[model samples]
Target: MYYLSSDLFFPSVSEANWDGVLAIGGDLSLERLQLSYKSGIFPWFEEGEPIMWWSPNPRMVLFLDELIVSKSMRNILNRNIFTVTFNQNFRDVISNCQNIERDGQNGTWITNEMIEAYCKLHELGIAKSVEVWQDKVLVGGLYGIDLGHVFCGESMFSIVSNASKVAFIALVNQLKKEDYKLLDCQVYNPHLESLGCREIDRTDFMEMLKGK
Candidate 1:
């Protein structure tokens, strides 16, 4: 893989290996992170590993028009049990995402450095959060980079059943109202697949990022 330096550049996404890792050793500066997402590349590595950038061949994404709300989710939405808001309590949202336990993961990728970097991005209005509140309690939420037409979802967490799902559905509805195009999910997971996210050719995904 290509090794990054202080010049603020990345190798072409086409150079990514079979596993989609394109480069390593880049600092997660705001400029680098913004440029990475704009180019359809993103950082995803373990806590102690060097910063690794990837541009997978089959990119998982959700086109706003294609978002699925199953009958169960529809019922939950009708109940209006959760209050959703945008860019509200971003730190809390990200912190929850960092601490919430997952099914198979032993640790979190949202390290302290990552959190500080993204929080800086948030201050610059380039990063955003979707908060799900239950009777004034921050029960669930998600955070991501807002790249104009696309929202590059980073992480989400739920303290109660379907809380994150409620936040996601609310986000979809808001994006639809604002005429946003795609939600970059990064990789395929059954959870996202159930929410109507699907993998498309990397070329297609890149083109979408360019508003093509």
Candidate 2:
């Protein structure tokens, strides 16, 4: 580990670690947060932990065209039981994502500082959110940074079954309409795989980030 700056300009980061912890200890000011995501980095740490940055190797990403809606999911979409919208109720979305308790996780990584930081970013238009509503109740949503045509998805939550997936589908559809190059999922999981997210080398991913 190298000495990370309290100020945001990342220290010389190492690709080997793939942790991509360029800097730490800085408040997630809009400028720093925007700059970090522009360079394919993001913050993830517990409330008491010094803000940890990450850019994992073999980053997980989903192409809009690759999304695989299953038969059941397709049926759900066809029924249109839920309504999807963009940038609606961002605060609520983040709040739910932060407050929702997950199995196995001792506590939320979405610290108060993180929440305020992202809220600030949302106001600046660099960060965006996708919301899912069922009969006017906010059920699911996600938020992330938008660097030119790439969307680095930060986090998502579902209050109801398939709600998160519905929100993700809307996000992908919107990104496709907007001509985004990629939807960076950061890390891989079985759920993301089922949604068509795949791993790509960090170098290549960065190259794609730069190319766009």
TM-score of 1: 0.98
lDDT of all predictions: 0.93, 0.84
Under the 3 Å rule for N, CA and C atoms, how many clashes does model 2 have?
Answer: 0
Model 1, runs deviating above 4 Å? none
Instruction: List candidate 2 segments past 4 Å from native.
Output: 12-22
- lDDT score for residue 40 of model 1: 92
lDDT of 2 by residue, 1-212 (tens): 44456555764335427455555566677877877777777888898888777777878999779998899999999998999989978889999999988887987999888888888888888778999999999999999888868999989999999999999988898889989889999998899999999998877788888864
Residues 55-124 of candidate 1: C-alpha lDDT, one tens digit per residue: 9989999988888999998998898999999998999999999999999999998889999999999999
Model 1, residue 30: distance off in Å is 0.8
Q: Residue 163: error of model 1 in Å? A: 0.6
